[model samples]
Target chain A: MEGNVKLITDDGLRLDGRSSNEMRPIKLQTGVIEKADGSAYIEWGANKVVVAVYVREAYPKHAQNMDRAIVKARYSMAGFSVEERKRPGPDRRTMEISKVISEALSSAIILEKLPRAEVDVFIEVLQADAGTRIASLTASSVAIADAGVPMRDLVVGCTAGKAGGKIVLDLSKDEDNYGEADIPMAILPRTGKVVLLQIDGDVSPEEFDEATSMIVNAMKDISKIQRDALMKTYSIEGGE
Target chain B: MKYLETKEIVYPGDRIEINDLRPRNGIYEDDSQYFSEYFGVIQKSEKFIDIAPFNSPYLPRVNDKVIGKIMDIGPTMWTVDINSPYYSLLHINDTPWHVNAGDLTRYLAAGDFIYARISVSNEIKESWVSMRDTGMRKLEKGQVILVKPPKVPRVIGKGGNMINLIKSETDTKIIVGQNGFIWIDGEPDNVNIAINAIKMVEREAHTVGLTDRMGEYFKKLKGGN
Candidate 1:
């Protein structure tokens, strides 16, 4: 409604020239940081995120859990990651994202095996697009795996939204700003179990279901890319 | 009876296709099915299936020989950094010396290294190391290097062949700890060669015929020298 702007073109293509069911290109790499126990870098659309994982004895002694290891995910964005030159350090938004991410990742990791230990996940967003939370979560999973932490499964995530009365996969910056609804979802690919899900704006039950299904399907492909990236790190050449 | 090809790379949650064999380290069971728990290579044996992870934090276990650096000396015990998530304790009574309780530092001070066996480990990861066993004592003269714990076996090689080769070739006394700490003692030059060879083994532990490759590598080094 702002100056007759249209999120979807008359040809059914989104502003980024993507189809309704098309997602942004994604690239994942593991072992990017030499000093971290495990590390990964991801480039999804215009989002660039790096994740590092460290497993150590739980500190502050009181925080130690006798039954399992605790996950602490810190999601931070650089000052130059956004167009507005955001301030660095943890804000309310980042703290919320970190909390949800920590809970989601805790479900995938085998915490019981590492009693009294803590797995720390540091997610740094060097660049930001629209769906940075999902990108960071995806990269964090790979980093945790790279650290050789036992996990039930790799977590993959995607975003879907309703733009111009049509549900679209992977909203870009512009679409996210003006879209009718946005739904970001993450899941454990092995069991198809939803781990992290958030819905913003208004959508009917039918539209929500459609968006979830779209995100889940896109996540399957993303999951394969994660596996391939990890395999690439340990591929044997000319070895029996 | 083998199932999937041995040494196949796998990821966490990847379903292992095998029958009758039980799961071992790096594997977990879920609803009667077994899945890998680490991003590692699969190893299948006649009776068990295991995963060898590329990298992981060391977990202390009872009876595991470990190389530790003394971190803090208390009245009755010395806390040690054993390259694990959990720090282990060495009680004054567990040491070879019969020293007074208040004089722990007199026997083993902070910053000294020791070779000991884990005497007690609990579900919560609290562990105590002991130096009472034979061949377990303070490591006085050596340079310590750390590698991934999973690669310890490769450094030891089949029946100690690789380690013995390294020891004799470089003329260095070496001790490999299950906790991924290695102690090397000899001429500085020989120690350097031993360190390089051990690092190479850590880097290519997954590759086959590593012993043969290491033999050729040593031959080339000696020929060049």
Candidate 2:
């Protein structure tokens, strides 16, 4: 699977004609859902994801933490989102993504300030691309901030991988399927702290360093887009 | 440290550089650096720097006046929903009426609204609302509307000017809860006017000269009516 298909053409551009260090276009919008405390919608390349954040009293009478709030992130995909129809429920893969996303967000939110409460983040993927997980997490952070939940910083992420014997910034569908290695990374942009990092497939130590550095730099642009989306929603005319 | 301009929109994690001013609500300090914790507007005064969030859940504080709706009844207490994440408890002893245990419904039944003050709010977010304070009692014959809790102060205005104007102009009685629940009572038409005015305030709460704009708005409304 490593070199069966040509991901990078003779011109040194990937299947989408993007350079190795170039990312797909991403569009972010905040305050999209009126009923939700905070909401965001994102279109990253071909993947479309919507996220909502709800702050409520922790329920079940037992899951309540006396000292801080809990973060519960649910990642769900629509049946038609994939090339093959995905079953409409939380499968094992979805559950794993949900857990990682929840933990990653908990590190950024100031949950201690909201004692005995819970912040629920719902991520719905309307269209599936290769990097849905990172895109969903990015939108969830924006939604949480829009809900006005206190946080240390917004979480932003990107993916880099080795495809066609070349290190690439973002993985396309074909590259993800046939690529040699993939690494998804998320970080707190303010402090450059990595909150979530996962590696799949094989890469040498030097290649791993290059992949992570590429992702870290890409995350800065994503963070700027997140802030601009929030500013668009809350910016007042003549505001200083 | 970078100097942050006051009244500028800021998102969570944006650094706020203030010289010697203490961090207040909507801000947090880490490693001697201040950063905003909410997507809101920055406000700085002589002694403090705070962020006024565009929207946030209601967080109850001790001694704050609030309007609540009775959701469930118990033998000795009633569960009240004060528009916050935590449901407050209103005990029988806290009400003005002399009622015995197990007879709570006779005084304040489920679905009834009350005006009360938060008497106790613990570290765990458990709170108790008391109706023993002055002007605190069962709210009857009024309509309750909710705004974002963070906008309550702007609805009230500096020194209660905005709310007073709305009440006097529309000939209605309005009680603004610090938790964002507002009670408006009067003739149906006047109540509608008051509600509209309050909604306007909620929408433009961040803008300056809102009080003056509201004044002219009311005059035009009255002339048309």
Candidate 3:
């Protein structure tokens, strides 16, 4: 995809004018929707994702786990989310993302505490640039907390990739398109254990270590924002 | 056991260090790390640590006073929505008087609201409601307002201080359902005042000095109106 295009300037800044260590500005708010048990709206750069958490009776009579709860995550992109209007419904990419997101969420949740119940997380991406999956996963964790489900920890997602032969913390749309290796990872913030990992391009062992370290560092900051958003929603002074 | 600071907001995965600090509702212990399972403020006591969730769904329990709307009238029972996930059954046997099973609407019709008590709830969350000798009756000529169920206890205040104050000052009759439904009946203006006051309580339930704040709020509302 490189055709005499400059992915990085002479000043070591990316095309979006952000340093390799910097990430897009993130804004997270919880309890945005009334009906759902928990809801959050997130704006990370140009990507906008809203997540709603619902707790209901487990269905189909047999999917019910007698000793633990089931988590179902649905990830969808709006028709206008991308440059080309995407058709609605579960595409193959979305189905795969949904499965991974669900698994990542269950990693942090203490599902055994919620016996015979189902925690459903619905993530809708209204606008997308890049890293929409990570943004939605981060917001969905907040929605889970907002829903008051018992959990062991909050899950945080961040992406780091190799651009211009350098590992950057968060990739922009252009960086993602032109980057050699894109790694998206989710972690349990408390334990620092990686729960979800996906690599789009190739990277060496040394590059993988550097990329994961960068994402782990970025996750600490994003996790703080998630906790702050929940606190602000329930704080006495911030109470609505 | 020790406890966290009152009114401190806690999130999932936050560490709690006290060895004897047993976690209670909305708080859980995993290994040696105690964390909050919900997004809520800490409600700590010497006995245990509990977190009051900011917002939660209404789950029916036996002996709970509730306000419900009749959704459908079956042959021998009426299905009522108590703002819970499951529909509560109001049987004819629990009604004030015995009416024939075929024409059940003669006692209570669909879309009608009533104040009742949950008599029984099995393990599966199916609850049966009763109106017999519980001061329960059809709610007529009132405004039904919904708030978060967790805020109900706060609106009631210590020994019902907040609700009683609102009732006396506003000169309104209010029935608070544990399931987050409120029935207010009074002069139009007084009812409006009570409704606003309740909303304020629901919004600022965890804050201190709420009773005094509500008193001033009511005074200002009356003076302004």
Candidate 4:
């Protein structure tokens, strides 16, 4: 959407040649770990995430306990997750991303059963592109299931950003660099609860509304992908 | 009407009707009547939240069996480290005891693994425990075979259906802890078969109607029985 790239052209198409609201390709896998309660791997366009979940003893903090169990997340971008290498531990950006992801998951799980128990979700970004947060959240949900933490519905998180002042769903790396605004949301595909919501950059009330609408619509398609990944892992998808 | 008035009472982030400004902006604390789902200190505004002793999931449930290693021995209680969020205390009275009144070390001792059912788990809201169930016992050799911790539930199945089938077909004694460590004892060949079966069920439990196939595999194994 900036130098050497056009958000959209004379033909009304994006630089990636998709429509205004079109998203990139997504590939998902669940239950790759042999030890964690749950684990999953996901690839969205060029971004990749490996998430592991462990449900064990609850946090000892007297204040953190909830009527239901709680979900704690540690999201770290792997050293090689980008064109340029990142450090091993989390950066402030990754920490903020982790908080957003945990909040998204907390809304989807039926945590009351564990009472004081805790579910720890760890996400390591093997590769990253424009939509890493959305991809990480998506993979983490599958890993949470692999961890066997019960939930009423799976949480699906994604984003639709306003690029060059126009709404485009699922930003690519270059597009993110030049995008004017971005909004990432976590949705309960079943109940339509917007569990997590975040926005950055400049947008009017009207632009925000338009972008939100696009993200809500996109959840249905992404939800189907989520279900498909579950089926593939559980052997429920026509495996003998 | 009081609820509406309370809502109208100014908190930093209270949602108000676009024009409902009575100018009651007070510094925010837990002073209002409306209850929050969880607690947090107001960072900047009512809308911005960050709770302290920040919530991390830890709860206990009925029928949950976890893997724990013995850490210490108190005068009358076995201090067990559950390697989880919760700490477990096993009283001498809580076991299938066959020992003298105060000689605590020999009968159960430390560093030994035992399989016990969660007879009491009000852990989220209360402290309660028990080791009084048919499944409760001091685990024995043939060793514990562990799969991924989260895969334990799939291996055990609903109402112990998966575990019972493995026990009956292989003619082995297997105790599966909710923590994911499973103790098995019987013929070596049978032990191997049970372990393989458990892994098979785990790898495919996410499949729709696939447990039926697992049952079929067991039926063939039980043909001569």
In model 4, which regions exceed 4 Å deviation?
A1-5, A61-66, A236-240, B1-72, B79-87, B96-105, B109-111, B115-119, B123-137, B146-171, B175-181, B201-225
Q: How accurate locally, in lDDT, is each candidate? A: 0.92, 0.92, 0.86, 0.67
Top candidate, metric TM-score:
1
lDDT of 3 by residue, A10-33 (tens): 999988889988999999999899
Model 2 C-alpha lDDT per residue in residues A128-198, reported as the tens digit of each score: 98999999999999999889899999999999999988999989999999989989999998898899999
lDDT of 1 by residue, B1-225 (tens): 212123678889999986887789998888889899998888888998898899899999999999999999888989999998889999988988998979887788889999999999998999999999999989998899998899999999999999999999999999999999999999999999999999988878887778998999999998997
Model 4 TM-score, all chains together: 0.72
Q: Which residue ranges in model 2 land beyond 4 Å of their true spot?
A: A1-4, A237-240, B1-6, B223-225
Clashing pairs in 3: none
Cα lDDT of model 2 by residue, B63-89, tens digit: 999999999999899999999889999
- Cα shift from native, residue A60, model 1 (Å): 1.5
Task: Give the Å shift of residue B150 in candidate 1.
Answer: 0.9
